[model samples]
Target chain A: MGSGSGVSCAVTLNTSLTPEQRALYQDVGQINHLLDSARTIALVGLSSDRQKASFFVAGYLKDEGYRIVPVNPKADIILGEKVYPDVASIPFPVDIVDIFRPAQEIDGIVDQAIARKEKGIDSPAIWMQLRLVNLAAAERSLAAGLTTIVDKCVKMEHGRYRGGLHFAGMNTEIISARKRKR
Target chain B: MTHRPGPRKFGFETRMVHAGHVPDAHTGSRAVPIHLTTSYVFDSPEYAAQLFELKQYGNIYTRISNPTTAVLEERLASLEGATGALVVSSGMAAQFVALMTLLSPGDEVVASSHLYGGTVTQLKQTLLKLSIKVTLVDPHNDAAWEQAITKKTRALYGETIGNPRGSVLDLEKLSRLANVHKIPLIVDNTFATPYLCRPIEWGATIVLHSATKFIGGHGSAIAGVILDSGNFDFSRFPAIAAPSPSYHNLRFFDTFGHYGFLMKARAETVRDVGACVSPMNSFLILQGLETLSLRMDRHVGNAQQIARYLEQHEQVAWVSYAGLPSHADHALAQKYLPKGPGAVFSFGLKGEGAEVREDGKKFIESLQLFSHLANVGDVRSLVIHPASTTHQQLTEEELAACGVGPEMIRLSIGLENVEDLLWDLDQAFHALSRSIRA
Candidate 1:
């Protein structure tokens, strides 16, 4: 309901932010670039039910031309993709690891992402879901030279990037600051 | 615009005005606009489908969510420190939805015997028709409460300041029992409001309100809200925690997490029952909430003075106001409602038999300031002969048990000058005496 809050209020907590790191996440254009370049997204803790936010966001990302890799112990498959138990279990390289888990679970997921990178897997950027934050996880990911995003949704970021949210009457903080690139 | 975020961490008074609200980006309206449309237009077919599927949180139909009502819901939840809330058609509807959300046909509810008569009827009769058994225990008896629960019990329910009786709930003892049993403790704080007491702070899992009362201070609207503390695990509750066939095996707790109960109540219960509050009533309730603290303060002050005045009067036999030192519940009220014992109270007239009823009616009719009606918590003073009006259907034993005596006259103290209220009652007692002589 806020101008800049967009679809998610995206309150970044737990993960300590330096002035520079805070600026990076707040910069809408930089976020837009990240979404544009991503090819595949791994949604950890994704559920099979359509009502779940993770399931919805994964479907949206797949529709937007990004391959969705479902990662959850409960599901055998989701969004027509084979489900993996964790980040390290994914058969192919994941460009982005978007976490849909709670704040408490983010640290473990981040740790797995770090391990995957250390074991010569692709260094996928980490994106934490809305309202979920872990400062230690963000710090560890950033220390390993990975692009870390916290307390934001990948679907909403893409929606804002394409100027597709205004038609839905969502608070598109996009048009004003970006000078109507659409 | 580049300031530190999370202004939401502000104080209650500030949040009451600003929470769940923002200037409309399109219209720049500072006030939350009442979205009168019954349905919202989706950006795409996929978007509409997603909303219907509960894949995302967005307004699809007014019955499920409206921007205006959503703001009121958020503001109330914020004021009560609840994780989420749902606003419905009336105070009764709010109670129904919240209870119905947790209850199934075979489940049970353990409730306090001292409660609003309508609520008593709701639990005893209506819930029975649904096959949901309710066990009522004397609120003062700790052992009775302990014995009422069975494996089938789904929730524990009571009122903060009971109707007619004005007895204060033992929140600590009640919370302890609820915790031991692992069932959610629910309190209807319609009388106390959050200004006086927050049931959540005392470990209540759910706090409900008949927004028609103090929440809407003015008698212009009928509304109710159910606020969840998000503390209940709901892990064992199949309706909330397990897969549902209604929405493709979707579990509300798995999806919404912390505010799972509220989300399920709004989406499933409200959608099926069709008891959502209109955007118009939602707007009016929000208006009342803005000055709630101010109105409640005056209401409490007037009530304390009026209760004391009636206590010393020769015509008055006894008063049932928790704020009074003579009240049986005064100690409990002091602990839970230290701000004051609220505005509504009952007092018995002197003399006995059928003549007491006549005198009670005459006293209420003779009053110029107090409006004689069934409603309470009005900005203007209201009077009711509960044994004859609100409790008319109840037998003598039932009425007496609820503290509605034959000589009882209920008064809802308002914001009128205390002198005028007392003077009005003073003259009414004279009228009762004059009628007796006639």
Candidate 2:
């Protein structure tokens, strides 16, 4: 297990350590494994305004091969995907639920995810958009035996982990070469 | 010390902080004061007549010009190495004024295929509705522009560093192409402010900025500025040079001499459209411009660093930044934007397969530090997933044409410490790793 300084997994461990924890651990593990296997994303908060961070990051992630799912109340559909008001409303089983809403609204979203989890719908993970504060809810989901990640940007992570950082438009091949060795 | 030239010849930094501004003439105030008044009273009827009839040039009305805004225009012009500039309400207005001044009904404009969504809509939809024809060309291909030109084409338009994709245009080639055809080359330098790349220096006759982005730095103000190089010989383009009914048979070239284009744009297009920059916004933009050179350096540095970090990550699929040597336009970027390609870049992620629970979208949803908003150019870092957001209106084929794919992610690096940014990224990937393990 990685060090849990910024995030605490204890709250999760205390609530569900039975077969469910192992099952969830396995489930999240498989989801990440599948992400390694596939390439496409559907971001919900993708906006068109350049002033909006969602606009650029979504574009970045799309450039990375993740089929983006832009979900916004104002936009009918984005990146060719029919944007839904909520995850449960989506017709398809998405691998991830990237939330770009405010921190306060995350609890209800987590509740929706929980409802879906109860209905035998197995989502791989619940990824919150950056700065989407919901530490308690993230812990609750983790306790429920689901994989939870927070406080990070999906685009930056993919770039750093997938060896895409070599394309910084400068001579940084040596750094990436070293990183690959790790 | 006695023999050394003062801050005038120091460097870009010193000039940005001090150029075109001195203590207030009346109060001896060292700082540029925000002159909020709407109109400057004339001393007498003769003075007002002189100001109105162009016998002299001074503040007549805030609608026409303001002292605070003048400082900003002068500073921007100096930075861009241009002879004159006009500050406007927003970058969009600046573009509108530029177009309105140069193009009449039935005239044509040759523009790049890869442009801001708003700009594309304006040219294809709004401008078309106005009876102005627009020819779209893939800026990547030099020949496409050559083939699109017509006798009615008045100007060639493009962005210095294309938005979203970060594709760098070869300004020298486009400028040469325009020159050969006797048309003006207008560039939107919003992405790459003069601090990074000055289009005017690269043969662009006119340059426009959103100023709302890095220029404002804080994302608090919406404003724009147009800089005229005053290098183009308008006489060669008789239509623009020979003005008539719009301004009382006054031939711009014959009267205004060097600052003809800028003067005409302000006097006519902006006057009618009423897209003048508000004094408050102008003051905000001026404050932002003072630190532009400094902020831009850090923005580029951090972006380069973060882009490199993301490109090497195991979960990433592809990366696109002109600063990246492997990028298709790296050579062009080197030639045009040698001072470091603008801060924004794009990348993609490896999505999960059916057996895995979280898909690529899930991975994005999992991140924590990055803010998922619709705006960019803030002091803080920003991120977005494009296929589903900014370009949602476009179809798959359209997205592909714009170089956007399913897993693509765009990142606009901020001025934060690079290490902290990387650490935040590292945690997100670790979560991804953990999720995959289950």
| TM-score, candidate number 1 | 0.83
Model-by-model DockQ, in order = 0.16, 0.01
lDDT of each: 0.80, 0.70
lDDT of 2 by residue, B329-430 (tens): 899888888888888878877763332224445655666767776567878887877767776776555566567767777778888888888887788778
* Cα lDDT tens digits for candidate 1, A45-81: 8888666778778877776678889999988878778
Best by DockQ: 1
Q: What share of the reference contacts survives in each candidate?
A: 0.07, 0.00
- Expressed as tens digits, the lDDT of each residue in B204-224 for candidate 1 is 999999999888988999999
